[model samples]
Target: MGALMPAPQSKLIVRACVGAAKEAARGHTSRASKEGCANFEGLYQDSGGGVVEVSQTKCNIRARNAAQRWSMDANADGIQVFMWDVVGTLRDGFISWSNQATWVILQDAAEAEKKGLPFLPRRFHAVCGPGNVCILREEREQSCRTRAFASRSE
Candidate 1:
């Protein structure tokens, strides 16, 4: 028999992951905001050749005119990643931080997608602490886990 096609839900997860990465790259290469923070929202092509919308915002209390803090919206057809007061610039550390966080979620999501396993939309929060370490927690769960990303010299 021919290989089975990935389920619709699985495809969406894979697409969202790819789209999230694209969005992160776009945010990184665009510019170093004069405000020292920016809000990025755009469409990205997914792994399966589909369009996915992604949005992100980063802010720091120490930054100039830092109006917004940080927020992310959950979407069935897209992905969102948010950071608050991350310690470095887009080229220096933000890209790596965002990618690492994306990969953490994507690792599980991709496995389920590859296996064609069913999945429900889930929300995750990644909070970065000292030493560039982050804790990712699912919105529904009480427990938290730690993941570390390399920190670039500022």
Candidate 2:
């Protein structure tokens, strides 16, 4: 495991502790995601991933990470560590109070294809940003309809 600094403009998928947060926000008890995950939601909204119900355009990684810390300190780890993709150029390639202190950087794009998809267990490698480390210990693949997604011009 390596570590660097989190960058601006990142996409992160985290399991939101929606039970309490939801109850507080909407005044109703909420259930976990259908996959038996605690709201495996994305902070950044993008149609790139087919998980519609779980995907959003808005970002809230900072809020979510802070909440997860609060949960761990207050209780056991309420949120599960799910895999994520965080890609962006950092402000100074170092952690700072003004920016996120942690990063979950996946292998560079060129490196990923060379060793097969980075999502594969063996091929997976990441660097934790400054504050702490985040790794994908295990992942449950969620199947989706690929045809619905427009091919990336890149």
Candidate 3:
């Protein structure tokens, strides 16, 4: 007798994942679905040969604005990546800070000053002039730090 025919694979399964992260915060997390397959297909004309293969993948993502700080957990495999876009002006913007270094420095300085102790001075460049010149001054300061960070990566 002929051998029994094998079961046909289902062609309606789909895979998807969704994630959300706060603006200028650290350690982003994702939510996963409990019922979903990794592949999908629909009725359509064959491309060339008799058999056909189809697949569809989706990812739902949401993110907020970054005011003073931003952070996300890196994947172990280094495959997934994230990016964002800014909108509107600073007057309508919201802010969030995640890095602890800023707080640590402020706390240490406050304690030292209370005891009449000498503390190392921390300096930051700022725009003092008015009008369009202010924007140019801000850009110059940003470029300095950007160049330094990019060079280290190389």
Tell me, by TM-score, which candidate is best. Answer: 1
The true-versus-predicted C-alpha distance at residue 37 of model 2, in Å, is: 38
Number of clashing residue pairs, candidate 2: 3
Candidate 3's C-alpha runs over 4 A off are 1-67, 72-82, 86-122, 135-154
Candidate 1, clashing residue pairs? none
lDDT of 2 by residue, 50-92 (tens): 1111221122222123212321111101123222332222111
Candidate 1 error regions (>4 Å): 1-110, 142-154
**For residues 11-71, could you state the per-residue lDDT of candidate 3 as single tens digits?**
1111111111011111112222222221111111111111111112332222211222333
Candidate 3: lDDT over CA atoms?
Answer: 0.18
Candidate 2 lDDT at 50 equals: 12
As a TM-score, model 1 comes out at 0.26
Stretches off by above 4 angstroms in model 2 are 1-97, 118-136, 140-154
Worst 10 residues of 3 by lDDT: 145-154
lDDT of 3 at 104: 7
- Candidate number with the higher TM-score (2 or 3): 2
Tell me how candidate 2 scores on lDDT. Answer: 0.23
Q: Quick one: best lDDT, which candidate?
A: 1
